[model samples]
Target: MSFREMTITLDDVLAFLHLPMGGRFYTPGYATRAEAAQTCALLLGGSASDYALKFDHVKTIGLRFGFLQELYTKALRDRRYGPATQMWLVHVVGSMLFACKSGGWYTTVHWISIVEHLDQVLEYAWGAIALPTLYDALGHASQRKTKQMCYYTSLLLAWVFEHFPPTIIQRMEVPDYTEDQPRACRRRESRTGHPELMERQVIFDEMTAEDVIWTPYEEHRDRSSAAVSVDGAYADYEPYLIPEGVPATIEGEVVGNYLDWYTTVSHSVYHPG
Candidate 1:
């Protein structure tokens, strides 16, 4: 919070933009620290809940109790909309309700402007978090990966804000939901017997572990430090494979045998090409 620390953080962010690789905190698309802080402030303002909750509260409860269910099902089925886009839409729709709950902003202008601003911020924030890594894995990934990330990250942001007014979620009394199984309840759609469920949710400490599961990382994940294989051949050497460079490849019959085995058993055939 100090001036010097703030300056240092800004410098760090600028430095991060300089890096060519993905997954660094300093990446380009993110809101600046100041912008992020402003968003947090506006979102957390006293009036935010009032403005956002009005529409959401009734719809959420209806969806929870099996009243109008087909809502989320169609949303889910839509190939064009991902989670993040859907969440921003929900926020925009529920703005007035949230404003009523928040009861902080004096003027309507503040509410409307903030909603538009937050929508833009949310869009950028979701991309900023995941794109670089996606690009790094392969020179480029399909739109599917982008959608996957957007959907999950938007859900993440929604869960974060749902608890903004503490009272709204507490009074709603719905079961906890996570990305895997997002709806704790449903609303039956009038035309189709389908039920619309809540896509984004907040979990409390009282919620059991069975209610949620955290996502696994996209890259190599070592669950434990326990040794998998020992290098007996290199035990005598302090540093093996020093000054990394290409090593000679096995040739002739060995190469032919390896190639045959690779072609026969490789999973790449079924993988994305």
Candidate 2:
């Protein structure tokens, strides 16, 4: 219930392990998209359908997991914390992999679920596990808003997650700027029409000034759709993943001091729509 009351440690983060399957379970940790796809394709021979699925169902969430894990590794590699501190911090970040949603492309539930889990440990860590705070810790600075990347807005981490792995480009078909329709429609179309649109949806996500409000959490507006699965088949719905404890360490200095610092600084927890 209270920050001081919850003492978290490393086993907390490493325990996380589920996510919306990207259909590429075979992809190795260090493999490039092309390489991973090849392996995943070979491993994906188990199905009996030709869904013609193109884009990774879990790309955005996958990237988020990847980015956060990279930070986790970096913290360890940098020796930023003592052995015990490093262990738990790395586990805390590793455990975040479970927050992503999949088996159904992008969903508000997925986004909202991830956001909620990201915060589960915040109360224990004085909110250090908060995504925005992690991005800040990662030193992802603001940039000028270009047609490609967000400079000052909250889309920084998103940009990184969506575009960081250059390998993703090789997997895309081509850019399709379907001007006549909104980005959402294009994404729907991309599932078939010009799959390229869906492939790169995360990178060049269409955002208006109004989308800024979506940060931190997205509104759940599709309760009716819950009755049906992505394939229009009936299915048993699973509950959201549980959250675990997370601890914050800063070179063995004043832990509460860092909490005070993080609480004062403002940052967006999620990317703008």
Give the per-residue lDDT digits (tens) of candidate 1, residues 1-273. 000000111112111222111222324334443443344234333243343443244332111111112333444566424443433443433331221212222111222233334435433322233333333322322344442221122222333223223321322333452222222121111233322222112123223433332322111113212211123324566465565556645432434566545555532222112
lDDT of 2 by residue, 1-273 (tens): 112111121211111111121121211145444544343233222121211223244443232334334544665777654332433433344344223234322211111222223334233432223333334323432443322311112222223222223322322323672323221211111233232544555433433333332221111112222111222211333344334346435422545466545645643233335
TM-score, prediction 1: 0.16
* Cα RMSD, each candidate: 22.8, 20.8
Best by lDDT: 2
State model 1's lDDT: 0.29
CA error at residue 38 for candidate 2, angstroms = 1.6
- Candidate 1 versus truth, CA RMSD in Å, comes to 22.8
TM-score of each: 0.16, 0.20
Candidate 1 segments whose C-alpha is farther than 4 A from its true place = 1-46, 49-273
